[model samples]
Target: MLLIEKPTRPLKLFSLSSNKEIAEKIAQAAGLPLGKVSSRQFSDGEIMINIEESVRGADIFIIQSTNFPVNDHLWELLIMVDACKRASAHTVNVVIPYFGYARQDRIAASREPITAKLVANMLVKAGVDRVVTLDLHTVQVQGFFDIPVDNLFTIPLFAKRYVEAGLVGSDVVVVSPKNSGIKRARSLAEYLDAPIAIIDYSQDDAQREEGYIIGDVAGKKAILIDDILNTGKTFAEAAKIVEREGATEIYAVASHGHLTKGTAEILNAAPIKEIIVTDSVKTDQALPEKLKYISASDLIGEAIVRIHNREALSPLFSYQPDENKDDA
Candidate 1:
């Protein structure tokens, strides 16, 4: 006879209004019902959040991504964390799938506010015990937090897709659309076992002038890696330069698929083969036939499982592309 044993303590998953679909996916993947919540706004534009389910002494994970309407979503996350703390939940973990304001991680100019650090401080102040975020604009932002934080990677998923598409080989080159993404591009390069190429760039009159390719891209397949694809100008310029350098094929990969403001048209006109990104950002229209999106939900779900179990989530950072396939 097989007897099922129940858990001594239950885990509770709460979803903020920020991104309900991804939150629901996480709960379903973990075999748990999403905790109920009622969110509203006052006449004065103040946001309010009320948890409808009991969470006392239970491990709680609140999911909210600070995307567009960034201020509102960020305020919601802060309020939720504070509520969870006062409700006596044993643990309060804030799972921000796409950490926003992450681009302003440092002060490049005098008197400039380090908004990323401010966000970190705000979370800690609002009673977040731990944090789980994916592909931050800068990894150093993790250091701004004193609490435990697991900075997840989207490269493994990208690598898997590339391997499946049979793109890994000596002829492929991973390109960083900007110098800021060189670190991320290098990580992908290491996974594909391919060389790295970088596009030298400078801004002039609100426009970008692509300089030259740092590595040999002549007669090689090219893959550009970035954390986010906003306007697609950087990508367009990089693709043009690589193609002019005699690259046979060009591909793009980003963790957060913001793909905003005519990105589709820009990408369509560019000399690119494929564009891949995760579903962190919701999209109603189907990605262009040339684009492929790999889900980071499983990786995120596994990280949540490990965090709930009090296990180290660091091991998930390493990439292991399968031998039979080579597409991410």
Candidate 2:
């Protein structure tokens, strides 16, 4: 007998104080209003959350990105989850656009802890039934959770942007900062029918040793893609070499715009022409004005719909959005 899927019920979208803008965008795409919630902090920095609207028997999606002030945002999310559970919500799905502390997934060195696994356990303890996140540094992080996880990609968004820029095919090189990212870089190169390039270097070494470029990019447009853009050192060094090797234009794209200290200065001084990134993590006052910011809010909103509908989410992976156009 064929299994039957249940029809999706209307969703109650709750925007935690973490990323209200992104939450509102998700709700608008889902044809729902942002759920009413009262959030505040006490003198000693304890967070309290009160759901103003009824959530009994309602499907709930709490949108929060544990980005800057990571601990505070996480506490708010936990409190919101507890609040929804107390109100007897049918299901509570935590939409963490940028899963924080994901980098510490494993201890490659001795005497270190795997904090990513700890985070998964913490979320379960906080009452999250499901998780939706984007472009994790390593996809294996999903296995840390026993609960279902939906991992979304911003590849299609980047592809679309480049296609419109008239750089999809021929005379273009899609570059990955390291060998680990070769798969992601190659996927985009195949989509654009362009060549792929890899920059091989160790972060610990400072002699500026010979870093090989995998594919030919001489006099071609080179696009460097990665998941995060913190510090921007890797891209800066790679951009300099590629430009000197005759890459006419250098562009950097990433899913998470961490934009940590010196990211702006590094990218600005590098041979790079444009630094493109999505709004997965909330932008603080540190976001530089020189970089180009693209919004993937609509794509994320669409994924939420398909996930709620219990449809296959693989189709949304590594898609390239049209270049030079804002996705409405």
Candidate 3:
């Protein structure tokens, strides 16, 4: 009789210094230990990555969020990808929760470059097999990559949180700060069975051109929805406008909290009741009382499992925009 042994599952998880906590949560959910790795910067400021364990023939996923210190984190991820490829890993999946350089997807001026596409090209050249990210500033960024890209949506997560908090109802209204976020805000409104409103505004010469509300938000619970909260100026202005138009209460939700340059101070001083964001970007420092966070671990962990098993990711990507049609 001949004896045959079982083959081991070759799935490995690693993380850069950008976001280790979220990566640990993903590892825990996937029932695996985080892969060992060491990274250090040279005296003159260069990144060095050393994979501490063997990953040959293994499916490797490197979790990193290019947020604050953008260039440093970006370089770390790129170098790690190169290292994993040279180590003979079967596949390298780059999991970027908050993808930096995403907002620069298009060139608005004559000499400007499309940095987002350049970043995509860099990742591909570094030998990335797959890319998984959440709520990109522009959905079209996925087209810039030749590899399989899974753009996950967080509206369901926000809906779950609102449902748990008993904040879903007809009295609530979802407002899009800018035109680009109309679809996202609509999805949230549909989930909560609420109405959708839009804030029409323009920027000109250090002055905020007075904007108008498209839908009725008077006496309603207004929830501002956006993809990112960078400087907090957009959301702050929207909140103020909605309040001036008679919105009873104001709350804000963003997929990535790229808070910087006194953004926390601006948000805390705004008229909004609470600002909710995800753990997609690391929040190492203490945040203001008005700012809160929700974890995207379970969603990302399940996606990882499905990808490893070659399962359909559509189930996790389902969203019904026509479920509720009442307008406010």
Candidate 4:
């Protein structure tokens, strides 16, 4: 009889205060325990982090989304990365489900700073070996980081949900809220074998003008897709236009649901029949009646497993039931 030794997988997962629920789910999917850590703030508003487990020579993954209280969460993530590096972790992979400051990827006007680049620089300087984020505002933001960046897409997850909801058909049209989201909307449309539509609009004095529907949405079920749903104003406005254009049913999907500051109320009152979003950021607020959430745990967990095993992440971008085996 011959005995074979099992290979060791040196991976450690940690989570900041940003989104603990998603972190726990990821850990469960990865079949690992969440690394213990504690954080506290001083009376003067300074943060201190202490990692309770050994990360020496281990691949450390810190899960934190820079969402509400953006600055605070950002600082916490930076501190965690620095701690892991100083503690001799082989690699510090920052898994930021929702990368804040992504909207500021480029300077649209004179003398405006590209804060996204600055954030990338900060993370690199803080000793992050790699970055893992989902559905970046712009594909160009990937260039902001010199280190490896895995910009995972939630399209497969969203498409899976739409199929499970029985929304895949010719009568369903994926609508882009703005020109920027045309590519994302098109991807979803392709996945469902549906048509695509774009909403054209202009804003003046903080008010949105009535949008024009570019494709045939009349008498069809419209599925509006975007990267983030911030104030829900834009989403609501687009939904209204689709409804007015004779859309039988309106459904909105976004990768990140930054539904803050009365956004939920706006969405609830809007004509959208259902608003689906991912657990990229914490959605613990008083959610609207039509809001639905899908977990990104399996997607993220498989990515982590592949990264730990030094495998390519491209295949994970597409929907694979075998890959997301434990997402349920």
Clashing residue pairs for model 4? none
Separately for all candidates shown, the number of backbone clashes (residues 3 or more apart, or on different chains) is 11, 11, 0, 0
TM-score of 3: 0.92
Best by lDDT: 4
TM-scores of all predicted structures: 0.91, 0.91, 0.92, 0.93
Candidate with maximal TM-score:
4
lDDT of each: 0.82, 0.81, 0.86, 0.88
Candidate 3 residue spans exceeding 4 A from truth: 1-9, 202-208, 284-286, 318-328
Which runs of model 1 end up more than 4 angstroms from their true locations? 1-8, 202-208, 283-289, 319-328
State the lDDT of candidate 2 residue by residue for 1-328, as single tens digits.
1122364565678888777877776776566678789899999999989899899987788899988888999889888999999999888999988898899999989999998899899888878889988888789999999999988877877787788789977789999988889989987888789989888854446655667777788989999998888888888888887887789999988888888776777777788888888777766646555577777666667677776677677767754443444543
Error of 3 at 284 (Å): 4.1
For model 2, give the 10-residue run with minimal summed lDDT. Answer: 1-10
lDDT for predicted candidate 4 compared with the true structure: 0.88
lDDT string, candidate 1, 221-243, tens digits:
99999888777777888999999
**Which of candidates 3 and 4 reaches a greater lDDT?**
4
Worst 10 residues of 1 by lDDT: 319-328
How close is each model in CA RMSD to the real structure? 3.7, 3.7, 5.9, 3.4
What TM-score does candidate 4 get on C-alpha atoms? 0.93
Candidate 3: residue 273 Cα off by (Å) = 1.5
Model 3, position 66: C-alpha lDDT score: 95
